[model samples]
Target: MAQWYQTWNKPLKNILWWLVIIGMVVSLPLAYTRHQTETSANQVEFVFDYRDLLDISDIQTNPRTFVAEQLKNMKAAGISSMAVYESTLAELKESRRIEVYNSRDAAALTQTLGDPNENFTYVLFADSATQQKLEPLIQKTFADLKVGTKPWSFKNRNGLIIQMSMDDASIKGMDPDPMTLQMLKDQGFQIVVRLSNRRPFVTNEMDRLLKQLHDIGVKRIIVDGNEVPGYTEENTEINLNKMADLLNKNGIGLAAIELLKEPQKGFSTLSKQTNYNVVRLHSFTEKDGEKLTEPLKKSELQDRIQGVADRLVLAVKDRNIRMVFLNARPVKSLDKGKLVDPLAAYYESLQGKDGAIPRIQEVGFKLGPAEPFDVKTTGWQKIARIFILLGGVSLIVLMVSFFVPEATLLLFVLGILGLAALHTLSANLYAQGLALSTAISAPSIAIMLAIRSVRSGAAAKWKSGLAYALWTLIKTSAISLIGVVYEVALLNHVTYLLVLQQFRGVGVLHLLPIAIAGVYLLFFSENNTYRDKIANIRSILSSFISVLWIVVAGVALAAVYYYLSRTGNEGQASTLEKLFRSFLENTLGVRPRTKEFLFAHPLFLLGAYLSVRYRHAVYLIFIGVIGQLSIVDTFAHLHTPLHISLIRISYGLVFGALIGLVLIAAWEIIIRSWKRWVPQLSK
Candidate 1:
């Protein structure tokens, strides 16, 4: 026992023993917990759509200049107690506030002899009385005084609001100075001309005003200050319907109409009555400016934005409206002459269902905290523990294989199978959406076992296999580590796109480590001249047979498989079995139809090719039994007849023969070169 331990122990350098033991011990808890968590992990996905409800598509018109000029006209009216405030560039930059210049600044600046130092326009806010006062001033300065006001106040001031109504005589007597009006008009000024006097077109007054407005070529009008008479709750519907029909028939495609009271009570009724497609209107107004126009706090803004978004969604869903036309007071109002705007919030909230709105979907389970001890209710720990335990057992078996040199062949077979089995398990776990912890750990036992066995045996014969396994383990570990790190940190939508890019990079680099290991193994081993000659001869003959008969058989079987897979044949499974059995019988001389003569003939290169033929026979049989089906084909695109033919012919004939040639050349060189470094191990 001591001697076996000594032999095995010496090969695994002291540093490696400590590393293996410590690394495994530390990884146990993490691996166990990771697997448990992975099993419980679930992804929640939701999809929302609000295209028909919030008809952003309908509002696509050029309103930029119109809004700017309207704000300008409001300022020019000299509406007392109304002020025009300028938003600084810095403020605009910080808040994305769209600043509109008032006509007062436009008129004053134009009349100045030189350009003013300031380069800003004003936003105006006033009560109804003040607005009416400003209307005459605008009429005096501008050719068209299109004055408008709601029955209720819609400005950011904290005082009593009084509304004044003038008689026809007073309106007729108010003559605007032509030159002043022209100057005001040149400075982008206009009138907020009111149409109704506390009621809609009574006593032929509406017809007369409409005629005057048409004669003057007035394009925009604000039909405000109209209060519909006597709402008997029961007949309100009839009256509202009458109003909508009348407005629609009149061809009034103006910007706004101030509705004095709630035309309809229910959300559905409001949606149906409000003709957003025709014009926007403000129904409710503030009597106390301080109460209505107050700036929202940060929290208030967030809540209001969310509430508005929710209401908008509900309105769209219930009303069957294509677009929404909001009252302009939200943006028009000001506090202490300063406009309190929530432009960012408003814009962000308006994003339709698919754009930014959260979708409602099913969520199965709540996620628990991810900690070593506190990992709540994920299956990662159980599964990870199993893999870690398997790895530990594999390691112990690997150590045993080191001393039991005769068991080396069995260990090698197990190692190869283990690698394949673990990788397949990893892929399955990944497909199931299990977290990284559920994946079987890549076995380093392969390298450890190979090092222990080869360090004590005839090195030349099996050292290549050991080197191959060693490099594969290292490559896989590096790849997995990098992939895990990337997944952990990736979150944003932009970075998610890079996932495919990273995979491409990894795939391109995959072959390099194997080539490097092959080179290292070739150079590091002691070489025998006689063995090199024999091995080379064997390699050449094997390559020829592999390229010819073996390749032909592979191509034929592959063609059958491809056809069967595409046709979705039920008989293909049994046919595959027969084909594989036949192939095995032909290559290994194992079935009733075996050719004894071929196995016995000395000229047939029996001893040199027997192992290759036997192994390939088994491999071919296995391939046939586990024939690639259409479902599998869809994923890997592996059943292409052309690709299969090319792989067999090119890899088997050209590359295989070339590989044999390279091995021969390398063996000969190694025989000469390695003699100086290492003595050949003798059985």
Candidate 2:
């Protein structure tokens, strides 16, 4: 028998290697899909209502102070810097100006003529209407005085470059009664003026406008994501350098805001340039803006807002940029002085602190560490619970060893009542269940009994090699299917919530009785004796741990369950997935179902054959029920209703019985051939 077993080692080794290859093939795609679902992000930096802060400005007298004070609030709120959009105010074609009708015709007439230099001159028109009216005649003399309106939308757009002053005529209503830029500078805010309405007019009024901007506090000028006059692919470098030199002469610097540009390349190039003091990127994200604007309940909106901020924190970490300009416009207007930091509330929620400025130090610069989204227990608590559950299981093992059937049943009823009473007394502490405990313990007891049965039936002389081979197969198959069952529950409840409160803890106590009976017959029986059981333990444990196929299958099934059924999990799954789940519930009012058709009945026949062929394998009968237990246990989840669990059991009985019949026939033939061949080989 030993020689015969030795012949199969090479094939076993080959199959073991194949298992690794198959596991990777099945698991990688599932893992990748799950990662995709979990790791999505929002690209915006902030999500808030600008109107929410108007009433809280430190300087109430200056309307412009609201902008400056709010800028300070952002810094206090942990924003590294900010990018403010600037005006595209165009002077009438005939004069030096900052405002004109937001129109396509005015856009075309103000085009600057010279290859961007300090020497360019501007031609002023009496009015933009007159400028377009005389374009036919004006073209003859001033060929370089360009005019068109490709940039401005028909909708009114006021160009407030920065809310500089209520008093400046040039920026009057655009930034009337707004925050002071100097206040932002005094508070150590790195201010970036994004050139929103890009030039013909920017270059047309470049020198004087830039001078006025520099005298106050504006330093860096954002040149990207803005269309400048004659901004061509070939002249990008020249245009960028010219803008930098213009800002440099005013004791200012250039900043690049990458909107649609390649992030790494744009950031890398701008970062390397000495004149570029601050390089950043800004775009309002969809989920951060539009989605949040949808008609959601107040709590849902807050959750979405926090989600956006978390993604923004991640975006900063990923890009290593200094500032992000989230379009705060989409954030629905809030009540004046609601004590919300609009965007900062997101980080505050995670840290559980108000107005915290801590940055995510590891990400180099960010709002702060992402906080735990859910509550979790400490390690000692988990260990203590496991100990209690094992104690409960151990009690059942004791009962089966010492008590008669009637006594065991009677005590179980009393114990359950006592437990329910205790649960009521400790309602504050929550109703604790032994489900996880039983989920773990039932398979162990089943395997242990199956092995004890094999040892008890062994030849009077121990260590019959042929007998060991048969025992190994039975052990492997039983242990392999442990905790293995088709998942069919309709709810998305996690089956193992440690803090669960329910009366179901007593239900799993039933397994304790089975464990007890098996313990007496398999280990402590007067007929079988302890010495024989001791002889079999090593083989049983070795076979249990060493079977690779079952271990791999168990792991694969776990991943599949998580991938398909986890909360927020979506697959190629739809109604069909629901139907597949329902099909496994193993029940019918008058007919048998899945469990009976696929597992229990077949297990029963196969187990019966194995038990009769090898008396020591008699525990296969209970092990077969363990397979049924696996089915009921799955539906036995607290989240599943009890009626469904019974239906699932019946399904298992019918389907399993059918499959068990087939497995029995195949196993009978295999065992007969093995027995016949063993005698011939023994010679």
Candidate 3:
């Protein structure tokens, strides 16, 4: 049976290669559908946090004048929307809508001794307009909380006396200030309401709030605190479904903030209930604003602002972010002996020459209210994905055949069975598993083929060797892109695009292909027969350990650790590297990845050229794995647009090849000079 299975391995592998090709052809249209979905929403919204503006304005000598000036500045800077948070007593005080005092303070103002037992909160309206607009809202909010309120007057200014302590009264949640919303609307600015789950969930109250917001043309709501609005009531009669229904009925969508410490509680459920009507938002936090304005010299400040602009542009153009939320805080400038804000810098970054607005508009986006992606799936997608699934499985089996040629058919059977079981358990797990497997397999196979070509023979001349190296690089990249196609096709869902779901096994995708290539190089590169390869591996395993070997192993391990550490978004970059990266972004609208263009591709190119002549240079094929894997890994970033990823990888290949040619020329000169001047030393 074993001999028969071994005999069929060659034919089975040949058949699997065809399956991979067919799968790639079938997946192309699926990729096109994803491209269409990505391009469906092209409007971006710039939203300023109104609460942060109010807080910053509080530090100014003329708070109202400062706010009015900033509002005009914001409009000039292309900010079209304001994010309004749910009101609290503290916020109302900041806005100067009302003043609150404890029982003792009220007694002092009245010039009468206070009763020792009375601990009521006193509210005095800023003006008649404030009194008329806020009195009902304050009364309703306290009524819902089962707290009593009575009318009062201080010097002819009507106010409310709440039968609760100042501390307790200040924390209660109220509706967003109607006056502020109406004012923002009248100013031609869109409204984005931020809701928190701190208040007791009341169906009628939420419905009324949503309806009022809808009347003002409010399109989206962002959840505040740690939970979405109705999360606390999920287990009760009022659940996320009901909340989602209210939002849907009121035509209000949700804004999914990117990179929160954790996703808002009940957000996923609410989003689903609302038919995935969600736009991705990227927030420039108050801390980030302060850092940008931190007492830097003129040049450094310009660089920091430019860096911020670059990030915002990328967030919109590449990462599917349609909402850019800007926050500002007053920074104490000891040098200037006053509080300064980054508002000016922020405005300039948006509307100045070479700013984010032009760049964003250059990339086919307009400043407007952001809309969610119109995700639609066709019936044909299901049918095409079947072929993609088959192709992915066959590719994995073909990779296994490289090491266990005799078990190719058995592995295919097992892969099919295992995938079926995985699909039964969870379709998402199946897709991610197949995606990761094919991601590693494609690059490993591509590098192995390059190594095989190297083992065959060296080119007779430098020119021919350089041509062969370039061809090999192109071929390897093309092969690696098979995995890219597989990944894009399998994970083509709005959830992945929104980052609600992620492509798992990224660390393995970055590390495993290189390890597999390294293994093939150690035991199988020179051996033509499986038995010989097994013998070579067993001999190495049984060999005595050496101190130098251990040292080399330790160094290799450390290099690998550092390499893996730099694989994800959380990876740290040095200041010089950040400057270099910014330079690349400024120069090339899309920055090619550093590892590919600088380290992986160039070395792979040089290695390919040199391996033609020198046997030891074959070891560079291990380095070649990095470029191939990176090409595939680039697509694994599901949020980035397909066109952007394609352009980035294309640039990586072009630039990497050019650098590799220079290295090849330099190597030739050194070799020739050594032979001419010092033949004995060269030998």
Candidate 4:
């Protein structure tokens, strides 16, 4: 049975390779379709927070005039939209649309003492238009909560008295201020409604509100709280589907905020229900705004502005963001003895030669209403994905077979069974698992193949070795990109593109390939037999510990810990590193990753060259694995456009090769110097 299994294993492995190649060929069209989808949305919107602007205006002596002037400034500064939130009494007061008073203040205005027994909330409109626009909305809002209201007069301005404490009445939620929306529209700026789930989900009321917004030319909305509009935890009837239906009826899509602490509840379901009419938005927080406008030197302020512009440009050009939300606050500048706002700096960042607007336009996006990607599916996509799955599983089995050759047939069978079980559990989990498996396997196999080729040939002279090393680098990167194609094919859904779903197992992708390559180098390289490698491993395992080994182990552990720390988005970079990144972004429209271009790719190229002659230099293949894995990892960021990742990888390879050539020349010089001088010194 054992001999028969061995006889079949070799042929089975060959079949697996064929299946992987066929899968890749089948996956190419799917990847191209995804590329088409990514290019569908080309317009970007810049929206300023209306509430933040209102807060800034409150500190001015002429608040109303200040707001009007700033709105004009905002429009001139390329801010095309204003994000208006649901109204509260406090917000209305801040906007100068109305005034709120408790019983005591109302009595004082009338020159009478407070009526303690009849404590009530009072509101006075700024004008007849305000009164006409807001009175019924306020009345209906409070009446729904069973709060009583009656007509009141204060110095001939029409007002209402509510039978509730001032504190209780102030917190009631109402529809977004109609006056603000109309004002924004009249100013030639689009309106982006901000919705919240603070009120009860009433279908009739929501329908009316959406109709009103549609009339005002509102194109999209963003949820302001932890849940999407109409989501209710305790009410099964009030769900995202109902909200999606209303949005669809009104022709308003959703704006999904980027990098929230926790994803908005029911957002994913709502996105799907709306047929993925969702655009990604990146927000400049009030805190970030304050930091940008801090008292700093002219050069420092310029650097900060450039950094912000680069970030915004990348967000739109590379990460599929269609909306940029800017927030602002008044900063207390003790040096100037006044409160300062970031409006001027914000404007500068958006409207100059080096501003975000020009930078964005240079990259093929126009300043207009942000729109969702036009994602379409073809009938052949599902069939192509099946081949991709087959290829991914075969590649994984082949990687395992390297260590367990006799069990190649069994591994392939088990891979099929495991894929079925995983798919039964969750289709998403199955796809992510296979993607991660193929990602690891492709790089490991590529590096091992290079190793085998190196071992099969005699060492070459430096002149020919240079060309050989470059060829090896190209070949290895091509193999790794096959995994990238499979991954993109497997996860070619709008959810992944929108980041509603993420590729899992990033840390494993970063770590496992290097580890597998290291193990292969130690046990299988140089045509070593399995018995010889097993004995070598046992001898090392049984040997007594040495202090040098312990020290080396400690250093390796620390190195690994640091490497893992830098693997994810949460890694902290130093100030100098940030400056360098900014410089790179300015010089190169799309910055290749630092590790790939500067560290991994360069070292990998050098390793490929050195491994030709020095037996000990084979260890560099472990480092080379990093470049291979990184190539595939770049595509794992599904939010990044396929073309952008390709450009970045291409830049990494070119730059890495150039730097590798320099290293090769420097090493050659050092070696010749040593050969010429060391012998004379010994004599």
TM-score versus the correct structure, for each prediction: 0.24, 0.31, 0.97, 0.97
User: TM-score for model 2?
Assistant: 0.31
Worst 10 residues of 3 by lDDT: 455-464
Regions of model 4 farther than 4 Å from truth: 1-3, 235-238, 455-463
Candidates in order: C-alpha RMSD to true structure: 27.8, 23.4, 2.0, 1.8
Clashing pairs in 4: none
Candidate 2 structure quality by residue, lDDT tens digits, 1-683: 55554464324333422432332233333223322322222122332223323323322455454555556556556553444443212212111222333223233554424233222222233345534533333232122333221222222331221112212222311210113244445666545554532334334345655676676556555553535322445655565455545555676553334335343223323332333244334345434454654556877766555555444543344333333555432243354332222334433533432111233333233342121112222344333333332334333332243323223334444545665565567732322333333333445444445545544564233444334434543453343223222111111121111112222443343354345546655455435445676766655667745479788879967854653343221334465643454333111322233334554345545655565456654555554544534543444343232333455555555556556656766876898999999999999
Q: 392 in model 1: Cα distance from truth in Å?
A: 7.9
Q: lDDT at 503 for candidate 4? A: 87
* Tens digit of per-residue lDDT, candidate 4, span 338-423: 89988988888888558999989988889999989998677888787678778898998888876777778898888888898888
Instruction: For residues 486-550, write the lDDT of model 3, one tens digit per residue.
Output: 98999999998898887888879888898899888787767478788888889999999999999
Q: Candidate 1: global Cα-lDDT?
A: 0.31
Best-to-worst ranking by lDDT: 3, 4, 2, 1
Report the lDDT tens digits of candidate 1 across residue range 1-683.
Answer: 76785565455444333433443544445433333432232221111111111122123243334333433433332210111111122222122122223334444534544234433223232344534444333333222233332222113531211121222212222222222223334554332233322332232433444444434333333333333321224666665554444433443323222222442222223223533212222221222112323576766655455545544433222211112333222233444454433323434454532211232111121111111111223344345444433333343333343334345435534654664566577743232221122111111222222222233342234334324323332332332232222122111111111111111122212222222222323332223354674676577567745467888889877965564353321333455655554454333322211111111111112111221223222221111111111111111211111122223222222322334334435654786787765764532
For model 2, the stretches where C-alpha displacement exceeds 4 angstroms are 1-75, 80-82, 88-180, 186-188, 201-215, 224-239, 247-287, 293-299, 330-683
lDDT of 1 at 122: 35
Error of 2 at 474 (Å): 36
Q: How many backbone clashes are present in model 4?
A: 0
**Please, what is the whole-model Cα lDDT of each candidate in the order they appear?**
0.31, 0.40, 0.89, 0.87
